[model samples]
Target: MNLYSAVSKSPHRSGTCGPNYLQRLLRLDSPGTQTILSGPESKAMTHYLRSQHDVIIVGVGTAVADNPALNCRIEGVGLKGQPRPLIIDPSGRWEVESEKGLAECVRLAEEGVGKGPWVFTSLAAPKRNQKWSQALDKVGGAYISIPSSDIDGKKDLDWSKILEKLAQLGMSSVMIEGGGSVINTLLQEKYLHLIDSVMITIAPVWLGQGGVVISPPRRADASGQAIPAARLHQTKWQQFGDDVVMCGRIKQ
Candidate 1:
């Protein structure tokens, strides 16, 4: 499991901006702060990430909330082959609503690339949104599930089973991105093997009730005390313009 975070930032703000006059102004360092990752750097990072991971995983909240197109073939970073797209939709709700959800499946089919637009849900089969299932089926994609009971006590969802299924479809590695709860669950269950971060330092803008960037939940023993610390291997960082990309491996 190779986890990665892909973020773009400007000194004026902390995320990417669309092409416009204002965006050009924001990129200038007149105010003593600079955007990290020039347009070229961002394109390179996207290409690198797509090449590195066979599968990319994100939570339902991310799928629904951000409605990200989540594909690798953006303008400058042409995806050589499609990487598998995986979504952890425990409740089976996101498939029906998200435009990003629909686009991810459709684009893969249109491009005729990669293994799947896979959905990892608690449901054993696809539901009422048969249109979504049909779209995926047309592209040789699938919806997979294991018993939710298996995940009950920080027991780890049967990631091995999930990996086996992906292997059958030819995926060799996975990149897990998140919307906090899923990140917390994966960390607590010790399911992650590596982590990558595209660190963004912003202009202190606050969204008082927004989701947390990282939330590694603690597991408690029977007496309710936190479990002992797990060893973290080491972290490596690379400069992407003024921002940093940090990667860490979890020790076995």
Candidate 2:
């Protein structure tokens, strides 16, 4: 699968990697819409990609909003060996006791063959959250401190930095399932070059709400207005259940 191929090339020069491939998948409504979007096909594709990738990443926003297990589940098929759940928790708010926190989720999934989640946070995390760290350890989940783009309380991160860290930790690839802003940064023109492939599952319905939008590639026109450039050049599309799956590669 190209999804696997893209991430397989995600390691570093100091380590082993087949090729440098960074891929992303998101579900969207129509085109240029920001809202909740997903269907049966998208669900199936999401599970498959999460299971296939070496690591699954969701920014803290998604972690808080969705509380996803990050495990592959397909009705009767069940989850195979699930990939590691990587949380971009710049604020250190994904505590074990935080209702839908990954720590608690892992504990609930402990009955199955699920592995603990891996939380990555900024160095500026509040010292008071030591108890949160303890809770993570209690559930087999671990928190790792990484570089941050911290400005006051507006903590952010460069995905490239985390990708480098993952490479060192023996993770050759990663799939980012997100909550908008994070994916927007990665897919922006400057960082877009880093991504190897793009896959999106589009549902037939529309949610006009400004929840979170999975943006497509864009470029500035002669008038300096950003316009929607073509998506992937070589893309394949398929209809599954109530949604359609689209896959394509980022042009080098």
Candidate 3:
């Protein structure tokens, strides 16, 4: 696994430090003090997905919230082949409204190159104001529904079935980028084989508790111990302007 950080460039050099190190040192008031090296990380992720994953799986929240084009383009890093896009909208409803200049599903539909977009939803058609499903259909994307009855009295989601479906559609590997809840569900089910994260540190700003990028506590056992503890596979450090990027991989 390759980990990369997107940070700003600065004259001062700060190496690998804990989460609290930034707040204790720099001033938060400076407008352009924080540097984000979005180029390299974005390029790395795109390349990894294109090379390894046959499909890209994202939760509806990511689609509605980020509205990412989900294409392969590295702003400064360059461009490469694109991968197929898969959205998991179990209810066939898209909850977020599109805002101008914000990431949205519509934007992705418009700019998506190569394989276009494919949505997975349970609804056959739109009901009332829940028209996201219909919109997806209108865009010429395919939708898949997992029969609700398949989970009857089952504690675990039938990931085997999901994998089978993806396999049938020619998806060998899946890269899941997500909102917290989706990440939690996948982790809970022990379905995720790999995680690639770009950890960045910014000066001054630190919010104790708020929105988290990743969620679901590392699995724990009945003995109050963590089950299947995650082990670090690799770590890479690089300076992007003022910030440092830490890339790590977890052994499956």
Which candidate gets the maximum TM-score versus the true structure?
Answer: 2
TM-score rank order: 2, 1, 3
lDDT of 1: 0.48
Question: Which RMSD does model 1 reach against the true structure?
Answer: 9.7
Model 2, 1-252: lDDT tens digits are 222224333441111000111112223433322234455455555666656676766677656655556666645434345767678887678655665444535764465545567888777776536776676666566888888764335667765677777777778666765656666656566555566666666666654453345554567879999776434668788787766666777554
Q: Would you list the clashing residue pairs of candidate 1?
A: none
Instruction: List ranges where model 2 is wrong by over 4 Å.
Output: 1-37, 74-80, 99-104, 150-155, 215-230
For model 3, the stretches where C-alpha displacement exceeds 4 angstroms are 1-52, 74-80, 95-114, 123-140, 147-158, 192-209, 221-229, 234-249
Q: What is the alpha-carbon lDDT for the whole of candidate 2?
A: 0.57
TM-score-wise, the better of 2 and 3 is 2
The deviation in Å at residue 143 for candidate 2 is 1.2
